[model samples]
Target: MTLEATDVSHGYGNETVFDGVSLSVSTGEVVAIIGPSGVGKSTLLRLLALFDAPDRGTISYDGEDVWRQPEGRRLEHRRRIGMVFQDASLFDASVRRNAAYGLRVRQSWPERIRHGFAQLVGEQNGTGDAVEALETVGLADKVDQDADSLSGGEAQRVAFARALAYDPEILLLDEPTSDLDPRNTAVIEDAVLQARDRGIGVVVATHDMHQARRVADRTAVLLGDEILEVDRTERVFDDPRDDRTRQFIDGELIY
Candidate 1:
């Protein structure tokens, strides 16, 4: 499956954030959006996630135009996608609860009832999936810990685990490790790669060049509210077609 945006333009009121930007990602691929601050990387991600509509453009998933679909269809489509915000927002509850929240909320009433019965019998349900995700992110032992009691990195890991537990077909990450230490960053990066290996399309927005280089199969450089370049990761960093891309890569450009 593929997710694509063609000639997308967006803004807040009169302020144009980006325009005529195009990008695509397919299952098992990791695409990194790299740019300086205020370059609209996060905005682009939101648009791709179908959280917002663009002023002028089309976003398609699996060859169907998302904006033209019915609300029910859109909601169903969204359920197959997962997004992790920059702040790694979580509930003021146990790690297991936080991780399972999405899966629980997405359950149909009949499914919920069945799960409830299963729970009463001491059977595994959403919490089982949540714990498995936690294990993937190295938080298995902290399943019962209060989310609020965890460190910043641990909280982010929980947020990631939450997304993974949903078993999304695509994952969108926005500056997930911007404030994390190297060890935490490495953990998240490894998780992302593992997810891709499982055939989930992954889109990551990051200002850290090294992180982008490490994770992305392809990279897109955003500047001036538009995508300046999109190419193989090595080519974008080592032999950019746009001078601005080169300048940004060398730390010689800033907004």
Candidate 2:
């Protein structure tokens, strides 16, 4: 029903990042976490996506604590969530191969069976799903191209396409369009909106307030180990209740 974190706390060694941080995103909603650099935005995204466990607190899906699940169950749970980083690292193989790699690694019985069948038939390039994912990101024609030869924007889109190929229930984006031009950013934003339309809960960690305002239904402002406020995007931008939120919105505070 929803993805949530309650009183989540984490740090490396003696350094504390945040404590008692709670956040949630319901299906079909996009929640943006915005803050200046080194404010634990990426760390929180990692926790939400189950890439890292919190030192304290729980991350739950549909009221069940995922971290407490058995390791196999946890891995299964992670399959329902996909994460896209700012860098969007891609392999040097063809885009189709790179996009389908995740599915191969997370192979369900049917996928394994199908892959075996494909190998038996000498049809190694059954990339229908990957091609469709690329089409979603406006790169259908690039499926057979070498991923390493792509431009920055194209490569990032391919990374997003790869995540989409699995059709995850939740999509965690960490500044996915930070390095793109306006056109490419718009393309990525459209892809995100399309994902939301398909009932995927989206959590975006961004430093760009404008991007948050554009894509987020709600926004959580993170600062120095705390979420100062989380509210509807318009309200958070136009009439924040917290002075710190207002200051951050007004560019008075830098981080």
TM-scores for all candidates: the values are 0.95, 0.94
User: Model 1 — TM-score against the truth?
Assistant: 0.95
lDDT of 2 by residue, 1-255 (tens): 689999999999999999999999888999999999889999999999998899999999889899889999888888888889999799878888888876777777887788868856867655677888899999999877898889999999999999988888999999999999999999999999999999988999999999999999999999878999999999999999989888988999965
lDDT leader: 1
Model 1: residues >4 Å from true position, as ranges?
113-124
lDDT of model 2 at residue 181? 91
* Residue clash pairs of candidate 2: none
lDDT, candidate 1, 63-136, per-residue tens: 89999999999988888899998898999988988999888988889998898798679676668888999999
**Which residue ranges in model 2 land beyond 4 Å of their true spot?**
108-126
**Count of backbone collisions in candidate 2:** 0
Clashes of each: 0, 0
